[model samples]
Target chain A: MRILLTSVFVDDQAKALHFYTEVLGFVKKHDVPVGEKDRWLTVVSPEEPGGTELLLEPLGHPAARTYRDALVEDGIPLAQFTVDDVWAEYERLRGLGVRFTQEPLEAGPVTTAVLDDTCGNLIQIATQPE
Target chain B: MADDLFKALADPTRRTIIDELAEQSGQTLFEICSRLSMKHRLGISRQAVSQHLAVLEAAGLVETRREGRYKFHDLNTAPLRLIVERWLVPRTSEPEENTP
Candidate 1:
């Protein structure tokens, strides 16, 4: 499936946006008003450009808030994103001073890695044979 | 809202439908059929689209609100968010990338 966007709900919108766009280098696609103290924001990979969108959902809704908290409490990751050149992408992010939780490693046919999002999640970057 | 959204988005047809409904209010089955046909060059019948829509709706990825003569299908974010959160846990460390 062509994933248009991936959404991560966080408590602080400002911090989430800073980490995702500034640190990770995901270009912002949208930043609009949605609700009180909430904004509908999105980003995408520079390689694919506008191919897919990454939604930075604010965590304040009772459902989203509870779910985010519970998942953090359980120490679970929300999701992962695929990159064409994972090793290159890993190094690029590393140069940007981005901290990684798991270093890049070959897992069978797929080369995978993980990073601490600092938003209470570990985002996985990988390249796998479809 | 990534994995479940990705899982919900796993199918090209459904992803196309989401892209179609990206900004618009909503659409009926007939409208969906025409748009998907012209856009994706799909030769599938309306029945096929209906079946696909059923999967989307059943997964809570899409919602159907009753309108006059047809059911207006609108995308739902709640299910996508919930499912992604649920999938965060490995659930006993199953093999990764087993399914698309």
Candidate 2:
């Protein structure tokens, strides 16, 4: 089976859309009304429009808050996206006032950095050996 | 306290953790684990790393800081002064009888 979609629980879908598109440079792929207060929102990389979709799920469940909070407290990222150069992306994002929990660090074959998504999640950007 | 410090420094894994922390003062547990497993080639579990951090924290060799929703671990070499005070400093301050 192909993995076409993944999700990160965001505290606010509107804010997530702005950060994912305007700041982090992801393109909006889907946006439909899910319920009274939620939307079926997703974003895809501009480079690979059809590659995969990241669902900006709402933090509707009570357990989700606890789960994400625990992970965030320890600086664990819920989602990771591959980049051309992590250091460059890190610098670019920092210029936009993005708060990084972990700066660009070269660990063995991979280099990564973690930034707060501002929607109650930490996202990781990495450059892995291909 | 001295016993705790020595015991914390006794483990190879713990020492490696200190070495990584020394390289970067403020690091998350996730970052520390990444360094140990990726950079150091250490085959260790995240829970084990957490326990190791606890030991270091008790020894006063590591300190944890809370900033907003995140918690970061920082290396503090202050407790290491005990080693110098207990042995190295005393020897240097002592009058050498052989010099007389």
Candidate 3:
């Protein structure tokens, strides 16, 4: 019944790890070898280590590439992360050379911004009303 | 070309799309759709929005650009110049009629 994990298809696990951990400030939660060239890598927010885990699943299926590419082309984010302040996070990420497809926009009660994940996906960060 | 421009601007939804694009150029189709639904309360489908963009593209009011793996939609008001030139400019020059 509980949502334990979610996934995003990454083009490269190594690069995704660096971006997710070093840049986006997530900590590695799991890194088990799956096969000869693949690993079951996952990362969790530093704020919530026991919370939901984000699996940086590899782009194994050919269809995943087409799907990701089409979504990226149209600036559709595969996943969304909640942030305390979208504008602050957007500025911080942009300072680190992260390219944003959409800037921070206030729509009704929520504010959001979209950034390129560099691992072939767009990620949206938002701040929702409490 | 003018027919296409006028037709593109004739719809309320398309005009709202223009208004959003004018606020910020170079947006993705997803962003545009998000704005329409979230900001403007437009509940149209993505396919319908895409079709509207195609109509706007044909009218030169919108231009799309490819940047690496991403494609962005940019608003181009150049075609709107035809509207000003077609009617507004001529009326301004004929002010002598009212001077009498």
Better of 2 and 3 by lDDT: 3
What's the ranking of the predictions by lDDT, best on top? 3, 2, 1
User: Model 2 TM-score?
Assistant: 0.94
Error of 2 at B89 (Å): 1.5
| CA lDDT, candidate 1, residue A57 | 77
| lDDT per residue as tens, model 3, A1-130 | 9989999999999999999999899999999999899999999999999999999999999999999999999999999999999999999999999999999989888998999989999999999677
> What are the candidates' individual DockQ scores?
0.01, 0.81, 0.82
Candidate 1 Cα outliers beyond 4 Å, as residue runs = A1-3, A62-76, B1-100
Candidate 3 chain A least-lDDT 10 residues: A121-130
- What lDDT does the true structure give each of the candidates? 0.68, 0.93, 0.94
Off by over 4 Å in 3: B91-100
Lowest summed lDDT across 10 adjacent residues in model 1 chain A is found at A68-77
What fraction of the true interface contacts does model 2 reproduce? 0.93
Error (Å) of candidate 3 at residue A57 is 0.7
Q: Which ten residues in a row have the lowest lDDT in candidate 2 chain B?
A: B91-100
- Residue A95 miss distance in model 3 (angstroms): 0.7
